[model samples]
Target: MSKLWLNSDKNESVFIKLFQIINNKYPNYASQWLNSLKDFGKDWEDEISNNISKVFGPEYNDRWEEAATGYAEFCTEALRAQVFFEKHGYYKASSYSDIVKECYHDADYMKVRYLPGQYLSHYIWPHHQKMLRHFVRELIPKIICEVSIFYEVGVGCGMYSQRSLQMMPKAYGVGYDISDYALEFTFNVIKKHNLQERYEIKNQDIISSPIEKKADFIISQEVLEHLEDPQNFINGLYNATRPGGWGYITAAINAGHTDHIFLYRNPEEVRTQIEKAGWSIYDEQIESNYMEKPIELRPTIVGYLARR
Candidate 1:
C-alpha cells in the first residue's frame, strides 16, 4: 500500500494509542482495522488530521493524546456495527418506528450509545469534521449570510451551533434534540465559549414539538437517518424556516452506524424528500470520506441547502 496520513509520526502516535487501547480490550482487531485506512492514500490522511485539529480547536494538541481513548471506543462501536452488517445484512427499519424511536429516546440507549463527548470526539471530530468545516466555509455564508435567529435540530454537542453563533456576530441560536446528554453537553459548550447569552438548548423532539417561532436560518446535521419519518422532519424544518431563509441539512447514506435506521440509497433520494417537503434545493454536496471495512465501497455524507 502507498503511504498514508497515518504514516506521519503525529498521526501514527494517535492511531497507535487507539490501537493499543482497542487491542487491550479486544485483541487482534485493532491492527487489522487500522490497516484498512492505509489504502485511502495521503489525501484522506491529511483530511482526517486537519479536520480533527479544526474540530478540537487550539486545545487539540494538548488533549489529543488522551482523546485517543474515546476514539478507541468509537472505533470499537463502528467495528461492532460493521460485524452486524456482515452477519445480518444492512439494518433496514423505518425511521421513527417504535424500534428505532426507542433506540434514540430511551435513557439507557442514549447513555450507552449517544454519549455526546465520545460521539463527537470519536466520530464527528475525526470523521465528519471536514464536512462541517466545509459547511462553515462554503455552505454557511452562501445559505444564510446574516441572520438574527438561528435554529438547529439534533444539536450534537453544539459544535455547529457554537461555531455558527461565533461566526455570525449578531445572531442568537436555539437548538433542539431528544438526548438529555446532548442538551447538557451543548449547555456546557455554550458556557465554555462565553456564548451563554447567545444560545439555549431544548430537549425537545423537533418533529412533534412546536417550533416556537420561525427562524431566519436553521441547521440539522447527521440526523435524518435516525428519524422514523425524515420527510416529516423535513416538512417541520420548512415550517420552522422563515421565507427567504435557507439552511444547511445533512444526512448519511449507506452508513451503518449503531442508530442509523433509514437506508437512503443515494443523494437523489435525499433530494427528492426535501422537494417533497415543500422546499427548494439551492446547493448540495456529497462525499464519502471513508471506505467500508474490508470492502472498498464508501458510505457517503450528503449535504444540501433548502430554502423556505
Candidate 2:
C-alpha cells in the first residue's frame, strides 16, 4: 500500500483521485490519514507540491504526493507506538556505545536514511524539516547579530549550514561529518544555494578529529542520538565553540526510529549533559506529534541553543 503511493506516477492534481481510491480500498486507515492533511488547510497541496519540486525538481513527480502521505503515515505509526508503550510501559534499552558501534559498522544506514532525496522525501520533508525551519527562524536574530564563524557537525543535508550562511552574510562556515554521502549531500546543498564562497565541508569524524579553530557558533542538530558517548560529543561541541560562543544541539526523546539508538527518555537528560559540558541552555523547543490523544503520548523532538 505504501509502495503504491510511493511509486505512483501521479502528480498533485491526482491527490484527490488517489485518496478516493485509497479510501475505497483501506477505509479505516484512509479516514485518519486523509483527515491529517486537513491540518495544513486547502493550500496544503500547493505547499507540498512546491516542496517536492524544490527538493527533487520537476522530474520527481512520484515524490510529491508521497511526501505528504508518508508523513501522515509516519505520524499515525509513531502515535500507535507511543500509545502501546504508554499502555504497557515496557521498552527496549541499549548502551550508547553499543548503538554507536552498530551505526559505525553499518555506515549504509545513514546513507540510505538521509542522502538527500531519500530522507527528504520519506521523513524530513514530511516530519522534521518544518520544525527545524521554525527553530532556525526563531533564532534568526541571534544568528544575524552574534554569529561569525559557524561550525556544523553531522550536516546531513546542509540545510542548517545553508540557511545560516544565507541569513548571515558576514558569517563563513565549516561543516564536518563522518559519512561520505552526507558530505556529498552537503556539497550539493551548498551548490544549490550558490553558497560556494561561504562554506567548506570535511569528511571527518567530528568527535575524534579535533576542531583546530574554535567557532563563534556551532550546530549539531539531531546528531547526538546517533552516538554512544553523547557526553564526549557535547564536550566536543564545547571545544569547538570559543568562550562565550553559542551552540545549537538537539536529540530525540523516546523517539524510536530505525537508526535512533540513544533514547533520552527526558529532555532534561540532554540539558544535564550540555550543562556538564559547561554550557547554559538559552532556549529550548520540544515539538510533539499532532495526532496523539494526550500529545505527551508521542515522542518529542528537542532542540536547545546553548552558550559556552
Candidate 3:
C-alpha cells in the first residue's frame, strides 16, 4: 500500500490501517478508488480517519473490515441491478414487503455486512462523502436558532444524527426505523459516541404512524427511494417538522440497489415531490455517478435543505 495519502507519521491510524486492509482485499479496485480521492487532500482523509477512530475506538479496524466487505457486496449488487435496469428500464423490486423480508429483516446481513458497509460508504464513496460534507458544512450551519430537538427518519447507521448532536451540543435526537438490526447498530453507535443520554431510537415506521411531536429539524437521507410512496413519506416529514423548522431530505435517482424500490428519473421529480409536501427548498445538491450512460439511465443522488 502507498503512504502518499497520509499527511503524517500516524501510519497505524484507523484511516491508514483501513486503506491497507482494502488494498490487501481488493488491490486493483482499491487502487483506483483511492486514486479517485487523491485530489481531496490529506486533511480530508485525516478528518474522516479521526472521526472513525473517535466513533469506534479500538474496534475501528474490525468495523472497517466489515465496511470493506459490505462495500464489495454492495457494489456487486449494484452492478447486477445496473444490468437489470439496462434491460428493463426500471428497478427490479417494487414491493416494500419483499425488501423487508430480504434486507431489513435479515439479521445476519443487516448487522454484519450491509449496515457497516453503508456506514463506511459515507466516508469512502465520493458522492456520499460529498453529501456528508454538505450536511455538516452547508446544511447544519444554516439553522440560526438553537436546536432543541431533531429527528432522523430511517437512521440506517445513525451517523447523521450522531454528527448532528456533536455539532449541536445541547440538542436531543430521536431516530425512527423499522429494522431492529438498524436500530441496534444505531444504538451501538450512539453509545460509542457517549450520546446515550441525548439520543433515542424507536422501532416505528413513520409512513404508517407519523410522529405527532414536531421537531426543530428532520433528516431523511437516501430513504425516499426505499418506500412505495415517497410522496406520503415526504408529507410525513413535513408534518413531523414544526412550522419554520428545517429539513434535510435526500433520495437516489436512477440508482439501483437490492432494497431501492422507487425509481426517480431526475432531480426535478424529487424537487417537485418535496415542494408538493410543503417544504420550501432553500438549497439543493445533485450528484451523478458520472457513468457514461445517458441522463435517464445514470445513477444519481439529490439532496435538499428546506424550510417547512
Candidate 4:
C-alpha cells in the first residue's frame, strides 16, 4: 500500500492550485523549499495505495490510481496546513533525536510483534537455535541445557539474541551495534520481550567492542560485511573462542549488498582465518544467497561451525 503509483494530471493540477494559494497567502515564503518538497506530489498519503487497484478495475493501473488517490489526500492536507500556517505564523517544535525513538515501536524481543518480518523471524534465529542445540549436545548432552550465553553482532532489531534467549533457559544475551537507531530498535525489542533480566543491549561497533573473556559459544550471523576492516574483528573473535568451545559464524559470499562496505565473499577467508586463530572449521555449508544466481555467483552466504 505504501508503494503505490499516483495520478499525474490530477496531482499536478492540485499542486498548481495549492501553490497558488500558498503564493497568495505567503508571498515572502521560501518557494525553493516548497519546490524541493514537490517530489512528494500526492503519494505522501499512504492510505489509498492498497485499495486503488481493486476499486479502479484493470484499466486504472492500480499503481497510478493509488498514487493519485494518496496524493489527493496529501495535497488537501498540505493546502490546509500551509494556509493555516500562513495565517497563524509559526509553531514551536524541537528536532527529532539523533537516535531513533523505536522503544515505543514494536518487535518480538519486547512484548509486541508488530515489526514486519520479525514475528516471522525465520532467517538467522532458526539457524542460531540449530547450531546451539548441536553445540550444547556436544558440551553437556545429558542435561537438557540451553545456549544460555550469546553475543550477536549487527543485532538488527535484536531478533538473533532474543530468539537465542527464548530457546535457552536462564539465558543471557547481548546485542551490540553502532547505529543509534539500530540500538534503539534492539532495545525496544528487548523491552517488549520483558527480557531485561537475561538480555543486555549495547551500542558498540562490533569491530571495536572489547572482549576480555571467551564466550561459551559466540553467535555472529551475517554481520561481517559492513565493517571498515572485518579481518581484525574476525581474528579477534577467533582469539576469543576457548578451546573445545564453539563459535558459529555466517557471512554472505560473492554478493553485492549496498550496506556491505566489506565482503567476506569467500567462506575460505573466514575458515582460513579462524583456523589460524586456533579454531578448526568443523563444518561449512554453501547455501543459495539468492537461490537463483549461478552456483558460483550465488555463493551468497556460508555458515561455518568453528571450534577452538
CA lDDT of each prediction against the hidden true structure: 0.66, 0.65, 0.83, 0.48
lDDT value for candidate 2?
0.65
Candidate 3: minimum summed lDDT over ten consecutive residues — where?
A: 1-10
After TM-score superposition, the amount by which residue 280's alpha carbon in candidate 1 deviates from its true location, in angstroms, is 1.5
- In model 3, pairs of residues that clash are none
Q: What is the TM-score of each candidate against the true structure?
A: 0.74, 0.72, 0.92, 0.53
Which stretches in model 1 have alpha-carbon errors above 4 Å? 1-67, 86-89, 92-113, 116-127, 292-297
Q: Which should have the higher lDDT, number 1 or number 2?
A: 1
Q: Measured by TM-score, how close is model 4 to the native structure? A: 0.53
* Per-residue C-alpha lDDT of model 4 across residues 1-308, encoded as one tens digit per residue: 01121222443333333333334443343242143234333442121222222222223343333333333333343345334433443211111121123322223312222122221222212332334334434422422253456677667656556556655657577776655555665666566566768877677654456666666667776666545556677777766556566676777555442233454545688677666767777777655423554544443556777776
**Residue 307 displacement (Å), model 1:** 1.1
* Residue 4 shift from truth in candidate 1, angstroms: 9.1
Ranking by lDDT: 3, 1, 2, 4
Candidate 4 RMSD computed on C-alpha atoms after optimal superposition onto the true structure: 17.0
Residue-by-residue lDDT tens digits, candidate 2, 128-192:
64456565568767656777789899887677787788778899999898766677767776776
**What is candidate 2's CA lDDT for residue 284?**
85
Deviation in angstroms for 8 in model 1?
Answer: 6.9
Residues 69-157 of candidate 3: C-alpha lDDT, one tens digit per residue: 77677667777898898789888999999899999999988977678777777877777878888889877887836479999999998
lDDT of 1 at 13: 37
